[model samples]
Target: MFTRMNGIVCLTMALLLGCVASIATADEALDKAFEALKTYKWGQDRATLGAIDAAVVASHKDDAAKKDLEAKLVAVLKSDAPQAAKDFVCRKLSLIGSAASVPALAALLPDEKLSHMGRYALERMPCDEAVAAMRDGMGKVKGLVKVGVINSLGVRRDAASTAALVGLLEDSDPQIAGAAAAALGAIGSPDAAKALGAYQAKAPKELKLAAADAYLACAERLLADGKANEAKMIYMTLAKPDQPKHVRLAATRGLLAAAGQK
Candidate 1:
């Protein structure tokens, strides 16, 4: 009986060793596939990065595994990789990153070529640090770069950023002003709606359309928040004869919708 038991123990140990080797092999394969993302391009004959992407990893990995993978990607962001490669990594960060990736991502926000991609990652990172990074970028960057960061902030729906966005409304650059107005509209906070309404009355004709659209968006948001009275006021402003015909018509429809809300 002792002899048979000893043989069984040996067999079990061998099987466990084999299983360990198999798992090790799988982890190495995944690592190799991820390396392909460093310089991947669309329509390539072999796109190995797809096999180890955020969606795949998230689906397969436990919390610990996911954190380990995220740390690796964050390290790649600081590597001497080409901009395109970094951009690819940034895109992946959107689906996997957390506050830990913020510093690496923030470093790219001022890069003219990479700011948009950088913000692309930051915008989707579900952490306060991400918003703070973009908010800081607002004051540090310029022109379209600034606009991109502002847009990301709006997408975050950061009510706390209302004052900063409102300040941009007076920027000399019309594109910047328009983008700020649009960002505020996307935020759709009561403060954002009020700022747009105040600016719409005196904003140049060139910026009127943006303000109008923003007003309409804010109204829809207010209605969703169960504030039909506030939404109606925005709709009323947009429906006036002075507003653009298409915008006024849209507002007219929005007005009816807001009124119908219980």
Candidate 2:
């Protein structure tokens, strides 16, 4: 009886060892897949990243495993990899669209190589950290970086950042100024209307479109502020034939909506 029992116990131990080895092999395969994706070769890298993402989605049932994989992904983003690779990682984090990556992504704003990518990623992020980063970067940054900052702040719809965006309406760069005006319109802040009027004065015909849209935004805010008549006037001015095509479109729609109320 003792000899038979010893043989059975040894067989069970061997089976357990085999199972453990198989699991280790699978983990190694996953790690290798992640590394291959780090090359960013497009076809192979995209495929590998897809696999990793699917694995992450499937492993949610095991909290510890999910956390471990996410930690690894964060490390990959922080690694000294090629910009292409880092870009892929940044886009992937944006795809995950969880607020968890906000802090990490915000930290990359000052990295010259990653600034544009970081801003693009932040546009998709739309969290407090992302808003704060865009607001803080606006004054000190310039050129395309500043343009990106404006775009990000606008997309986030941070009401508190409206003042900063309004300030950019006077920016020397036409693109920056125009985008800021558009953002103000998108935000629809009542306080932004006066600033937008200043923007309209200096804006060219093309830039006027942005200003016209912003006027509509200001009009909406006025309506909410119990100034429906003032909103109606601005809306009518926007719809004039002399206005740019885009401005006329915004104005016509606003006037139609207000007229319907009568």
What TM-score, over all chains together, does every model reach? 0.86, 0.75
Q: Write the per-residue lDDT of candidate 2 for residues 93-132, one digit (tens) a residue.
A: 6645345566666667767778777777777765577677
- Candidate 2 TM-score versus the reference: 0.75
lDDT of 1 by residue, 1-262 (tens): 5698899999999999999998787778778866775665555435576556733455454777767777878877888776766887888788878888899999998999889889989998889999998998789999999989988887888888899989999999998899889888888888999899999987888998888888888888888999999999999989999987999899999989988998
Q: Candidate 2: which stretches are off by over 4 Å?
A: 1-26, 37-45, 59-67, 97-100, 110-113, 204-206, 217-230, 240-242, 245-253
Off by over 4 Å in 1: 1-11, 30-61
Separate clash counts for every candidate: 0, 0
List per-prediction Cα lDDT, in the order shown: 0.85, 0.72
As a whole number from 0 to 100, the lDDT of residue 233 in candidate 1 is 94
